[model samples]
Every structure is written in C-alpha cells, then in structure tokens.
Target chain A: MTELEFDYLRAYLKQRSGLALTPEKRYLVESRLTPVCRRFGLATLRDLVGTLKVARDSAIEKAVVEAMTTNETFFFRDRTPFDLFRDVLLPQAMARRAGQRRLRIWCAAASTGQEPYSLAILLQEAGVKLAGWQVEIVATDLSTEVIEKGKLGLYSHFEVQRGLPVQWLLKYFTQIGEQWQIAPSLRSMVDYRPLNLLNGFEALGTFDVIYCRNVLIYFDTPTKADILGRLADRLGPEGALLLGAAETVIGLTDRLSPNPQHRGLYGVAAPVVRAASPVAPPVSQLRVAAR
Target chain B: MTNDPAETRTCLVVDDSAVIRKVARRIIETLGFAVTEAEDGSDALLRCAEAMPDVILLDWNMPNVDGYAFLQALRQRPGGTGPKILFCTTENDVGAIARALRAGADEYIMKPFDRDILTAKLEQVGVVQADAA
Candidate 1:
C-alpha cells in the first residue's frame, strides 16, 4: 500500500475505532483488509481506500470499523486476573458495598464477551448472597459484529475449550449441534453494546469496576490518556480499574492511582483541592504554653 | 466374546469443546458403544460418580480443571470400578503419550482423528469387539 493510502486507512481507523496503527502494523492492515478490498470488488487496496474516502454509505464505514477492531479474547484469559477477582476484588467489593443492594460492572472492550462471562461464572461459584444483589454487567466492544456474536452466546468447540473451566462449561453451556450456547441465566447477566471509545461516553453511566484490559496498547499516548480520563470520570469514588498485566497508568493519568494492595489494579484517586485553611500552632509551642 | 462390540460398554467423552465432544460421540457410537459427554474434568468426575463408564475418552487440555488432573482424581476413586481411559488430544508428543500411559491411560489418540483408526484402537484396548456389529 502507498504511504497516502496507509495514512488514509490509518487516519480513518483512528477516527472510527480508537486504534492508532503504527508504521510497523502496515502488514497487519494489508493482510486483514485485502479481503475487504476483494469483497468491495476493488482492483487494489488503493482503490478500496479511495472508495472508502468518498463512501457515504454507513454500512461501508461500519465494515471498516468492524474489520479494524481487534477481537482477541478467550475464556478466563490470563488466569491471574480472574483469580484475583475471585480471591480478592469481588470479596473486597462485596464487603465495601454491603450496605448497597446492587453492584454494577463494566467490561470495556469486552471483545466477544469472554471476560464478562468469566466474571459471571465466578460470581455464580461465589454463591447465593450475590443472587439478592441487583448485579448488572455491561460489556461493550468497538465491533458491532463481535457484540452481536457475544449476545448470541454461541462459541465453536475450540473457542470454549481455550480457557473455560470444565465444571462451569458443563453447567453454563449446552451443546447445540457443534456449538456451545451459554446458558440463558449466565447470558442474561451481561448486556453487550457497541461503543467507540473515541466518542463521548456520558451515556455509559458509572461503574464500580471497569475492566479495560489489553486495549490501550493499540492507541496513541494522547488517545490512551483521553480514554483513561473518561474511564476515571465514569468510575465511582471507590471503584477500581483493572488492566492487562502488561498495561499500567502510573505516569499517564493523575485521576487514577495504583492500588496499594494489588499490582496492575488502579483506583480513582481523590481529587486534589487547593483550598486554604488557617494553620494551627506547632505542637511544641502548644506544650510550652500549656506548662 | 471379550472383543465383541455388541457388549455395549459405555464410554465417556470429556472435552470443553462441544464440537470435539460431538465428533467423539459420533465416532464412539459408530464403533457400536454408548457414549456420554462432560465439558471438563470436574463434570466428568461427577458423571463418573453417578454411573461408572467402561472407558473414558479424555481430552488433555481444558480450562479450570484439566485432563491430567481428572485422570489422577479418577484413579483415586475407591471400589475399583475404574474405567479404562484413552487420552484423546491434539498434543501428540510420544513422550507425552508414554507419560499418559504411565499415568494409567490405556491408549492415546491424536486429534483430527480418523474414525476407523479410533475404532481399531478401541478394539485393541478391549473396550469393543473387533467383529461384533
């Protein structure tokens, strides 16, 4: 692909999906988009890009976004996080929110629903007190196609076998022909939506825990800061943020701070205020005066 | 008489993938034995508890509880109605197969299996009769 075409595709993808493709990712673009070019009956990728530039059709743009969005996920991916959630996070959240009769979690970039469903299965294993709590999990992805597939809750045999625990699989999925359909009870727990992080997110509402793992590496630094800021704004006072083990926001944002108890886990830090207060007398002076 | 496929010995196919389980079920049924399925080792163990099978076609990989763990647990069960297990998986390292056999696997079959090969192997393990239809 020509530099101009690469720039056009990259810029369009940056605008549509929050992913900022680097120069090294050129091959990825070529391999992934070649079929798109063929499907559009364009002679070349350049021709496809040219058509996309003037294409007024929403379907074409949707197709481009869908193709660009990465849907890399497996059941119970990166075992440690799920282990921490079960062993540490959920218990902490439950204890802290004991007074409230509800809990809300958001899996941003849920990517075919593995992460959220994993959480649901964990919650189910944790037992019945959770049943009384009004739990609502919102799973969002940039790709409408992936979101629809997540809602369908059907996975090919190999897909479910990847990281899914056997007992949970037998309990939560039913074999329909060659596909495993997630049980209705577990499927009902998650609400999936198509959300572009580049756009405004006031409509998403606040969440107690936001899992935006393995997504920030795709964006530019500025985009990462912007997305994290928005995520912070949507986080409740005591809400926590979980990222991929390789991802961190330590220097990226002042809005979130690393949780002292857990690595790669962040919490919405209390905002700084510059309001002035009259200084109290020194402790030594007070002791002398009392004498 | 011992090799007769008409003996109708039950076999449990344990795999997290519905597709693999279905394929294994079809192959096992074609070999003239009844088949049951479990998505993981834990479920497989529970099913074994309810009704002990004559043989188990166990996948080597699964999330949460895996194949090796299930095999160990199965061997630990008392009263010794122990099912003869065949390791069915994609990992075909000869050393791995040897280790599985050491761990009490009666046979090992690599995945993307041929139906005829599986039937012949089952017959060799004495789980089915070679001539019984």
Candidate 2:
C-alpha cells in the first residue's frame, strides 16, 4: 500500500477507534487489512482504503476497527497479576467494600475472556465470604468477534495451556476432543460486552477495579491521555487500575497514582489540581519492568 | 513393558502450563511409569509428602513458588528418600542448565523437544529400560 493509503486508513482508524498507528506499523495495517480487502471483493488494501474513505456505512467502519484491533490473549497470562489480585487486591477490596455488600470489576479489553474467568475462579476459591456480597465482573473488548469468543469460553488445547493451572483446568473445564470449554459456573460469572474504549463508557457504570493491561502501548500520547482521563472518571474513589507492567500513568494523567503495595497496580487518587490545569505532577510514577 | 522391577519407576510432573502437563503425561505413560501432576512448587511438595515418586519432571518458571524452591523443599523432607528430579524446562541457557544440574536436577530437557530425545534421557536415567522399546 502507498503511504497515502496507509495515512488515510490510520487517520480514519484514529478518528474512529482512538488507536494511533505510526509509520513503522504500516506493514501491520497491510497484513491485517489484506484479508478484509479480499473478503470485501476489493483488489487491494489501497482499494479498500479508498472505499472506506467515502463509505458512511457504520458497518464498514466497525469492520475496519475490528480488523485493526489486536485481540491476542490466553488463559492465566502472566501469573503474577492474578496472584496480586488474589493475595492483595481482592482481600483489600473485599474488606473496604464490606459495608456495600456489593463489588464490581471491569476487565477493559478482556480478549477472549481469560482474565475475567481467571478472576472469577479466584473469587470462587475465596468461598462464602463473597457469597452474600453481590459480585459482577464485566469483560469488554473493541472486537465483537473476540467478545463472542470470550462469551463462549471455549479454548483449544494449546490456547488453554499458556498459563492455566492443571487443577483448575480439571475442575472448571471440560475437554471435548482437543478443545476445552470453561464450565458454565465460571462462564456465567462474567458479562462480556463489545466496547470501544474511545467511546463513551457511561452505560458500563463505575467499577472498583479496572484492568486495562497490555493495551495502551498502541495508542499515541493524546489518545492515552484521553483514555486515562475517562478511566479515572469511571473509577470509584478507592478503586484501583491495573496496567501492563510497562505501562504507567506518570506524565500522562494525575487522576491516578501507582499503588505502592503492588507493582503495575494503580489507585484512583484525589484530583491533584483543577481540571483546567494543563499538567500536574503525577502523585507517583513507577515503571514496572516486564517479567 | 519391562519385566525388571527397577524399571518400574514413579514420576511426578510439575508445571503450571496445562499443555505441558498433557504432553508430559503422554511421554511418561508411554515410558511405563505412573505419573502424578502438580501446578506449582507448593502443590508439588504436598503431593511429594503423600507419595515420593522415583523421578520428577520440573518446570523452572512458575508462580506462588518455583522449581528451585520445590527442589529445596524436597531435600528438607524427612527420611531422605527424595525422588531423582529432571528439570524439563524451556530455560536453555547453558549456564542456567549447568546451574540447575548443580542445584540437583538429574537431567534437563528443553521446550519443543523431540520425543525420541526425551525417551533416550529417561532410559539413561534407568527409569525406562531399553527392552521396553
């Protein structure tokens, strides 16, 4: 594809999905969009870009966003985060929310439902202390296709093996031939939704813990700033945010601060300055090296 | 199957990855040994306390405890009848493998392994008799 075509698609995608694509990622667009072009009967990515430029159809735009979004994930990825959730986050959250008798968590960009289901299993293992409390876990992704897969909770042998524990697998998953389907008890605990992070999140409501891990690296500075602002607004006062080990809110937004207790974990901080301020010193900035 | 009683060894499989467990189970079963599995080091130690296997296939990377901790725990157990352990892991750095062997791994296997190589290693360890082939 020509630079003009790449720029056109990048600009369109940025405007639609808030995902920034740089020149180095031009090949990524070509490779991913080539299939879309073929499916649409367009000769090439350039042709597809040309058609998309004038196409006012919402379906076409949706398809572009879906094609552009990367939804790579597997069960129990990077075990430490889940350990932190079970050992530190959940216990503390449970104690603080004891009065409310309810808790809410959102796994933003939850690809294929692994993270949310893993969280549900952790809570189930915690037992009756959580029984009386109303618990809801909402898992969302920009790709409708991946969201469907997440709801289905079916995984191939290789996919399930990535980080899942055998005991949990034998207990919560049933193997049918080479594929394993997560049991209904675990599947029913999470509500999967198709959500574009750039869009309004008003309907999703506030959450006590929001996991937006390993996702923001694709976005440019401005998009990250906007998404962080929206995420901060949607967090409860004492709520927490979990980012990818390499991600941070430092120099980006002051609405959230790094949680000292857990690496790659952040908490909603009180507004440091009025919204009108261009930038405020981040309450705390710590870069968690990837394990 | 081997008629030699010494070849009828027990093996424990410790890995957090379900895929690895499934593959290891098939390999160990084919070698004519009873296999038990644990997800992490802590769980493996608990299993070890109940039944001491003749050999263990341990993965290096795991959460809530790891292969090194499990090895140490095994040595600390009373009676000193600890099973021989082979570190079957993806950590292929020569120095790391040497360190693991020094730390008490009887053998080391790399990831994306050939079944023939694994079987040869098992035979070398006397867990599987050559006649079993």
Task: Compare the candidates by TM-score and give the number of the best one.
Answer: 1
lDDT of 1 by residue, B30-130 (tens): 76678899999999989998889988999989987899889988898873246877788876444565677767777666676666556645655666654
Residue-wise lDDT of candidate 1 within A235-276, one digit each (tens)? 988898999878889778999999887777999988888788
Least well predicted 10-residue stretch by lDDT in candidate 2 chain A: A282-291
Query: Could you give the fnat of all candidates in order?
Result: 0.00, 0.00
Q: Give model 2's DockQ, 2 decimals.
A: 0.04
Model 1 misplaced regions, further than 4 Å: A273-291, B1-133
Q: Which residue pairs in candidate 2 collide?
A: none
**What's the DockQ for every one of the candidates?**
0.04, 0.04
TM-score between candidate 2 and the true structure: 0.68
Chain A TM-score values for every predicted structure, listed in order? 0.91, 0.90
lDDT (CA) for every model shown?
A: 0.82, 0.80
